[model samples]
Target: MFDEMLHWPFFDERHRALRALGDWADSALDDLVAQEHAGGDVYALTPQFVARLGEAGWLRLAASLDGRLDARSICLARDMLARRSGLGEFAFAMQGLGSAAITLFGTPDQRERYLRGVMDGTRIAAFALSEEGAGSNPGEMEMAARRDGDAYVLNGEKTWISNADLAHQYVVFARTGEADGARGLSAFVVEADAPGLSVIERIPVIAPHPLGTLRFDECRVPASAMIGAPGDGFRIAMSVLDVFRSSVGASAVGLARRALDEALKRAAARRIGGRALADYQMTQDKIADMATAIEASALLVYRAAWVKDTTGARTSREAAMAKLFATEQAQGVIDRAVQLFGGLGVTVGMPVESLYREIRALRIYEGTTEVQKLIIASGLLAAASHGN
Candidate 1:
């Protein structure tokens, strides 16, 4: 189904093989989703699924063979699993996002101890950056860490954290001083069983995953848990997001593709005005729009992915553009699919409806549409001011 993407030549033979592996997953994923349904607990089910993905060597692709984050592999895995199942994509992505700090900046000892397990899926990873009061404004976070002896005592609450209950370890960001704003923030690695760490509550969404609030009351972690230097948390957080945000767009493309596929099947089979719905020019127009949206979105997503792979540049602007366009366009495409489906589109258990719910969160998480716009505009204005 993704074969059309080969036209761009953004990928190599190994990437094609990954796509084939993803195609193999299409049949098997129903069983995984069914198993998830039987358990009825995403928290419990996610670790097992992640472990299975690791043992199958798919999770290994989250990082390079030597254990650094692999941009292309991360993008490919997300796009594939997203096409199969939204939850599956979430499970795969958190591993890469959660481990990215260690991959990029961890000490040798840290990588030896943590990243290997993350790559093998023996350890589940979570990125705890968002707080109840600090959604888009990272500077507003109240979570603070103060040093005592060789440990940092973390105190405050982190909300809207994905994999909160299930993560074996979390890369948490907190203010390291009384200084105001983002400058005071630092990142630390906290174990699931660390002192004074607790899950306060689970937050449910339209398309649910493992999510909850994490409270840290004097939660102490060794100083060695800090990634890079203190006062570098903001850069680290932005770097991780810059890399993965494009993949979020890729996932949107996947969801849009599924929505388009379902709509196409319905349009071809359903009769309207004494002929198939596909026979209508209006239906053809909608299909054309959806197809065009997918194609254009794919171009943006892969271009960002490729640029990162080849240039090793900080991709803040490129990633912002990809996420901004693909996600918003996906919303439009899916809406058209639903319109084409009519009442059947809104029906529960329908693929397009699920895609609708799944696609909504992609726009909100990673970065909101509004946030992406700000990033893009700021970059453009900065470049203009520099006469570049």
Candidate 2:
């Protein structure tokens, strides 16, 4: 179903190769959910899964030497992975999200030390930004890093962190200056074994992964551990999000595509009044709506990714638009698929039911639907104010 979309002018030879690679990578993940659950601890299984992705060299696409991320490739990889396994998508995305700051802003030494391990699958990476009081508004983060001689002592907590205890290193954001709001923040590379760092709690959400709360009690890291200069944390965080946000939309598109496929199969096989479900006008209408939304979402997602790859400009507005439409529409599309499946849709262990759980968090994470709307509105207002 997604093959035709790859032929669109928005994609190129490299994008096609990435899609092919993703397909190959995903073929082995058929039992990822079961494998994860087999250990009786889904979070504990994340490191092994990430290692597999790294060993396959699929993680190389997530990082680049020139400090430029290929949004199109990332979107393709995420879309393909999401279609097959949510855990696969999560592992791939965390690799990118966790290491994006280092790729974009790390010093040569930092890159050499971390990037190699991250790409090789020997080491896991994570991004630590949200706090107890800060989610949508990261500017209110209370995690503070106080400079002490040759090191910075980190003292606070980060919650809802993916790959929390499993990551080898974390791109930790903390307040470093007296300036109010986000201006005071800075980014740091905190090793997992750092003296004061500990996983205080594990959090289980609708979709399971390695999520937990991290406590930094006077966790001292060398000043050399900082990703960029002081007060650059907010900038780095946004920059990373700007690159990855559209890919989140692409993932949603993939999940929706899978849902639609399942619905079509169900509709074709299930009979109503001695006729196929697909023969019914209402069923046709639902299928039409699902296909239309998926196509529109693909366009928006790929357009945003293309702009970022070609123009090298901040894609705040475009990314927001793509993420907003794709995630919201995916929920609707999946819901329709559930309806089509009737009782089986709501039943445990069904593909559509699993998708229902997986797609819900995409809207809440990365950035919420409400946050995307605000971003789009703010962009429009700013453009109007500038008379552009």
Candidate 3:
């Protein structure tokens, strides 16, 4: 089912990545899967996975040296990876998200210093944009950075950051003015060991990953560490997200596909009343709906990626639609898979049980489903007014 979707014009060339990457993942990421099923220490496992992915050259797909990203490739990579393991997709996605600002809008010196480390997986990276009050609304950010001589002294905290304590470097956004809201924000690169910066609290989500809050009390970073110019943080962050948001949808497609596959296999094998579960009309109805939703989501995912890669346009409307539908629907697909498995589905260590936990966070992060609706409607209103 997934292979057929690759024939879409969006991925004529990049679709080739699926086969090789999928084969590599099944073999190389087996240990990661076993660890996740056993509820292993995700923090300890993160670096090991990064090193392995880097050594295998998989991380290179996430870093764009020329500052031109191929969204289809990114979507394909995320789709294949998420189907296998949630943590695997998280590791790969962070390499791109953490350094995307630098890759797209950094000085030559900045790129030379940081891009390669992430591509090679030696530098685990984090994107610190969400503060306690700014999870969905970044404009409400209270984290501040005051200019001190040639350095910027940062203060306040960023919470719910992925790859938190495990990251070697962070792409941080903070307020730089008195009260201009998001317009006063600036983006900067700060190493983990930077003075006066520390992980204040580790946050455990429904799924396993390194998430936490970081506090900066007079943390001084060189002025050169800034990505783009002052007042460019909001633009830079939005630009980066515009490209990666569709990739999030692709990840949802992968998760949904995996759920569908699990459901189909179980229906074929599990029997009741002296017949296979797949023989029942109720089971067949579910299989049909899950397949339809997966295909619809996959089309939206690739369409958004294609528009970004080919047209170089801001995919606010398209990406939001893709994200809103894919994540929300994938949750439903995975839930049905769990119901199909009955008592065994809720049991820990079962594949559907793990997936149930994994699918919940995707809806909440990046941009929430509610946030996506606003974006889509805003785009529609703007387009209508412009007569486009």
| Candidate 2 runs further than 4 Å off | 33-40
When 1 and 3 are scored with TM-score, the better candidate is 3
Give the per-residue lDDT of model 3 (tens digit) for 287-385. Answer: 999999999998998899889888987888888899889998899999999999999999988888988998898888888999999999988898899
Residue range 225-318, candidate 2, lDDT tens digits: 9999999999999999998999999999999999999999999999989999999999999999999999999999999999998998889999
User: How close is every model to the real structure, measured as TM-score?
Assistant: 0.96, 0.97, 0.98
Sliding window of 10 residues with minimal summed lDDT for model 2: 31-40
Q: What ranking of all candidate models by lDDT puts the best one first?
A: 2, 3, 1
Pairwise TM-score winner, candidates 2 and 3: 3
lDDT (0 to 1) per candidate: 0.85, 0.90, 0.89
Measured by TM-score, the strongest candidate is 3
Q: Write the per-residue lDDT of candidate 1 for residues 153-180, one digit (tens) a residue.
A: 9999998899998988999999986467
Query: What local lDDT does model 1 show for residue 1?
Result: 50
| Residue pairs of candidate 1 with colliding backbone atoms | none
Candidate 3, poorest ten consecutive residues by summed lDDT: 10-19
Candidate maximizing lDDT: 2
